[model samples]
Target: MKRTILVLSLAFCSLAATAADTSKGAESTAPTCPVTGKAANPAITLVYEGNSYAFADETAKQKFSDDRANSLYQKLGGKTAIDAAVELFYVKVLADKRVNHFFEDINMNKQKRKQKEFLSAALGGPIPYAGKDLRSAHESLGGLNDSHFDAIAENLLATLTELKVDPQLIEQAMAIVGSTRDAVLNRPAKPATPAVP
Candidate 1:
């Protein structure tokens, strides 16, 4: 009789352990955003909570766009501010003798359009980018060295400051840009040259 009782107790313990494990897995896979308290779409929920490369949801996306525009407008003192910042960025780039050559043949109008679209998209606005892929565009630049990339980054920060954009918004925008560093700087290795006979 005592042996049978012990067997039943062991069985109950096993069932309890299995139930606990199932609950844990479900909790880990749950799709709620800790930030906005909204249920994330199953497809994108994993992105927000999973790896670093995940895209933002619609709410996060809109927040980014609105924050950028507001920051730029306030930082630069309104529409006039954004215009001045843009002008300053180009002027600084053109003055850099080493890298200026890269932009010598560029179409300013088209470049401006792309910049606007890129900024809008980064901020989570409705604009869909129509520009060339970033890697393809920079591939022929023969690899942007660290200094060259730093110079551009500095100029952008300066422009943001001159426009009087909020510090937090500027930081957020910079972080977004930083995420692309690897793709921008590290090109795929060139194919091995054929061996000479």
Candidate 2:
């Protein structure tokens, strides 16, 4: 538990230090709208949730502004924030006994990079995720159950909390992550059985 806290503290400080250095003069660095896949016009930038985001045009900008759940990637802080959160999230996961064994033979460096990509794209970032779909990725990890899933979710929430993420944003994140639960657990799709005639 102490280790978890220590890891999160260091990660939070690291992100803070980095943000302090770049945030002073930072403009909206995103060059395209994640939703529209179109060139972002800097003049059309919208400052949503205190973060400025550039959109391809007024339509894309409006879409982003109108949707809170879809704009979480930016609302929570965009690429830099996602990277830091993933780092701390992994630290918590590795320390937790509940889900650590599943990662024993995995390459953490690659895993972290993939996770960042997956989450960035999942949270509506412009980049498309290139990794295997969730079912293929976790299908080999036999016996994964809701408990393991819960532990991972718990660690993620902890990471977000330690980083002082807004509760509302955390709720959005959890919902997005939860949407992947069935696939992550390798559950087969249960097609609706035809009702007895």
Candidate 3:
């Protein structure tokens, strides 16, 4: 029992260190109380998605808890759910012919970790993503087109479906992901055409 506890302690320390490393030198932003817009009391901390978020007081903490409980992230089972979905999502991505080529020289472990962070924050997880913006990250992927993007999106939808996620939630997630298309594509938005005068 002592050995098991020690092992778990080491594993947890490793994970916390890794998260700190990913922050890449910048200190974590101090959380503000959402209700009062004041600096949070460090003692009133709540752990979410493996990170601690401080609240100004017990009341502020309660409000944040209430809001998070109804969030899509919470609805989808928080970090564990997002992590599983991203892992499965990438397995599908790498096996797909249309997208697999782009990842041939990539470090898949790092890629998977980054993807998890990106998706979690995008889906309203408590932690903010610390990776490159979408445009800069994909700018070097030559010959990427709408078809390739579609292939990626399709695999994501299929993966979510196979996981038996709620269809409405899946749709909402897709819509949010889809909104990143222009940035991911590394292009300026096409100007809207004016109506005929």
Candidate 4:
């Protein structure tokens, strides 16, 4: 009778330990995102259209984030080059009579800082953007059309050239600006009326 009771107690302890192990393993292996849900590429989708997403692998995600940050820092002339580029850009924009009106109500100092943050983040630098999204911020500007975009792009090109940035890198940066065309021109500019003949 004593031997049978000891055997029964050992069996129960073993079962309890096995159950605990299984629960722990399940917790560790659980999926971060559901298998049937949307993908995790934020840039590919429109601003507010997608469901929530998660990185498929934590380690890979960290690597990607780090690479982006480093690339942006290098692309924007590093820490020192950013200030020069920003200054040049503003100067060029201010000198252009056609687009100066758009910037008339802006606080130039604040805008310079915001542009720095934007470039840093977009190029994968370590800075977090404090500025509003392009569409919302520019929506109130009347007559912001493709011509305005072209003027901005031209000014940016001239600024980058003055900063001695590589032509290829400048091209790459300009490509980013082109991507925001749709967002920046959210509304059509009103056409000017023709004089009677």
Candidate 5:
């Protein structure tokens, strides 16, 4: 289960990098409190990762701050760690035959930077991801399939493991990454089965 999540997260991270778009510049006009999901108090705002977030109250502000402080992005050592992982991941990917073709014509430096941003956002970093959604981006790949996705995930898992990231944290990050599978493949989301009591 844990391995699966890490792989998926890594796969999603790579996809995020190649096709992401820029987000709006930092603004003070957040419409809701990310912590409580309530209307924001314009006066109770904070800027993080180049974006502005507002809170309903002091408690909400603190809660949001604490969450960011404890996020997987923070746990993985922030930008430095993320940057190192992306670099290592691409080395493995470029050497792999299964998915390297997809990136054959891509500008890697830009892709690496985008991947960092995507992984940071996916891992609960302070900045929200404003890139083109996964489906649109992956759709442009034309020949993507499960095996390709799995290969990317595997590379990601290996990269994290080699980096000695905590097992539990890798699992958490992977679960988040795995959630993007359907969209990354540009397929329909699987419907949840109804509960049978």
Candidate 6:
């Protein structure tokens, strides 16, 4: 679940701007609307549960407000479920021949804590992530590739399945993880191809 949420949350963050400027009178830094991925109007805002959300318009603001009750974080049983999933995931990862080498000499206690924090925030938990960006963290691993990522993702899916999480949710979560592939692999993004005239 943590893996799923982390991927989804990161995907959401990569696609949408959850942090739009909400200052009372100042001009915004062109914050993108989480609902529309368009520049948000600082004046159009909603302060839900202490997090101020800026919107492109009233409709966007309303959508964000309504969606809060069903955030991925809450749906994945929040912190408790995330914690359990991360713990189980590490066990699988550590046991897997494909990815175990990545953690052989690392401090697991700290790694698990970071993973929990990262996945929690990625899944929309209240706390923001305070760790190394994915690229930098994995760039030093020399030969990291898609196959390794696939292995880790496979383990995550297996863990979630064993935990009996809903299949639909797992699919959603996997899509999110899939979006992080390039970043996790530290690869340069493919340039957008031009549209046919």
lDDT of 3 by residue, 5-73 (tens): 001111222111111122333444366864567998978766554456667899877877776765666
Candidate 4 structure quality by residue, lDDT tens digits, 1-197? 01100011112221111101222112222234222233444322111001222345544345444454346355444445565677778989999997998888799999898888787677655335778988888888878889999999999888777655666777778898887787789854456689999
Question: lDDT of each prediction vs. the true structure?
Answer: 0.51, 0.74, 0.72, 0.59, 0.77, 0.73
> For residues 1-197, what per-residue lDDT tens digits would candidate 1 score against the true structure?
01100011112221111101222123243455433456654544222111211123766534533443344222323323333456667777788775788788899877765765665555443234667666766777875787777777777787666545567656766787776665567756566699999
lDDT by residue (tens digit), candidate 6, 1-197: 33333222222221222233233543333487878889889898765433566789999877765565456765666666677778889999999999999999999999999998988777676457989999988889989998999999999899778776677777867887887899999989878899999
Task: Give TM-scores for every candidate, taking all chains together and pairing residue i with residue i.
Answer: 0.52, 0.67, 0.75, 0.60, 0.71, 0.65
Error of 5 at 73 (Å): 2.0
Model 1 worst lDDT window (10 residues): 1-10
Tell me the number of clashing residue pairs for each predicted model: 6, 0, 0, 3, 3, 0
Order of all candidates by TM-score, from best down to worst? Answer: 3, 5, 2, 6, 4, 1
Question: What clash pairs does model 4 have?
Answer: 68-124, 69-124, 72-123
Tell me the spans in candidate 5 whose CA falls farther than 4 Å from its real position.
1-56, 193-197
Residue 168 miss distance in model 3 (angstroms): 0.7
In model 3, where is the ten-residue run with the lowest total lDDT?
1-10
The CA lDDT at 170 in model 6 is 78
Ranking according to lDDT, highest score first: 5, 2, 6, 3, 4, 1
Residue pairs in candidate 2 whose N, alpha carbon or C atoms collide under 3 angstroms? none
List candidate 2 segments past 4 Å from native.
1-70, 190-197
TM-score of 3: 0.75
Q: How many residue pairs of model 3 clash at the backbone?
A: 0
